[model samples]
Target: MKLTEARQQFISNWGAFGTHWGINRTMAQIHALLMISPDALSQDDIMAELNISRGNANMNIRELINWGLVERVIVAGERKEFFSAEKDIWKVVRQIVKERKKRELEPMLQLLDKLENTEGDKKDKHMKAFLDTVGSIKKLSKQADKTLDTMIKAEESWFVGNLLKLFK
Candidate 1:
């Protein structure tokens, strides 16, 4: 396929994938465009190419920036801001995993910590049941955290690819 067509295909596919991962589609598309483009694009260029409004483009661009997936660029003699994506796919995956863990898992772990330590009616049946359930949930959360740490660490090593081959 032609470069332009390939770029568009990547944007659409990545955008759809992003939606499933809780990121807005346009933000992912904007990142995808930057990832593939030979030259960094100004906000206006992104807006016109994506057929999105200035606000939409600006908002999603900011979101991507916050996620550490994109960065602002300044062209010589140009006052307008341009953006570019971190093009290494593995690095991108690492950032996404880090961000997701911070946003989702950390808060849940804190809740589990607080709920486990809360001293309520110790002799009450309701308190007993709640504690039982919370204990199990806390255990599960710890295991999930261990799994996440293992996965993240494995991604940086050769073992991940080796293990994937076993499943295949």
Candidate 2:
């Protein structure tokens, strides 16, 4: 297949994959396009390539920036802002894990902390059950938080080695 067709397929797949990570299809598409581009792309370039409205492209670009997967670029003598994705695939995965932990797991852990503070008699069966469930979830969440933290800080080789060991 042609490079254009290949790029289009990648962007579409990436957009669909992004939804599972709690991001929108357009955002992922923007990232995918930027990732594959040899040069930084202006907002107009992104819109033209993706066939999206300026508003849609702009909003998702901003969101991708917030998530640390994309960065704004400055071009000499160019008034229009250009953007690029973090081209290192390892860094991209780590950034996504870090952002998701911050946006999802941290808040969940906080809520679990709040829920665990319920003011009720300890012996009450319902309260006991509630605490049990929350406690279990909290335990798992904390472990996941730690594991993700390790992943965010770990070198790619070490992480990959240990991961592979699990299946071997």
Question: In terms of TM-score, which candidate is strongest?
Answer: 2
Give the poorly placed runs of model 1, Cα more than 4 Å off. Answer: 121-125, 150-155, 165-168
lDDT by residue (23-139, candidate 1, tens digit) is 999998998889988889999999988899999999999999999999998899999998999888878887888788889988998998889787888889999999899899889
Per-residue CA lDDT of model 2 for 1-168, tens digit only, reads 999899999999999999998899999999999999999999999999999999999899999999999999999999999999988999999999999999999999999999999999999999999999999999999999999999999999999999999999
- lDDT at 146, model 2: 95
Compute the lDDT of residue 69 as modeled in candidate 1: 92
Error of 1 at 22 (Å): 1.8
Strongest candidate by lDDT:
2
> Against the true structure, what is each candidate's TM-score?
0.86, 0.98
Worst 10 residues of 1 by lDDT: 151-160
Backbone clashes for every candidate come to 0, 0
Name the regions of candidate 2 deviating beyond 4 angstroms.
none
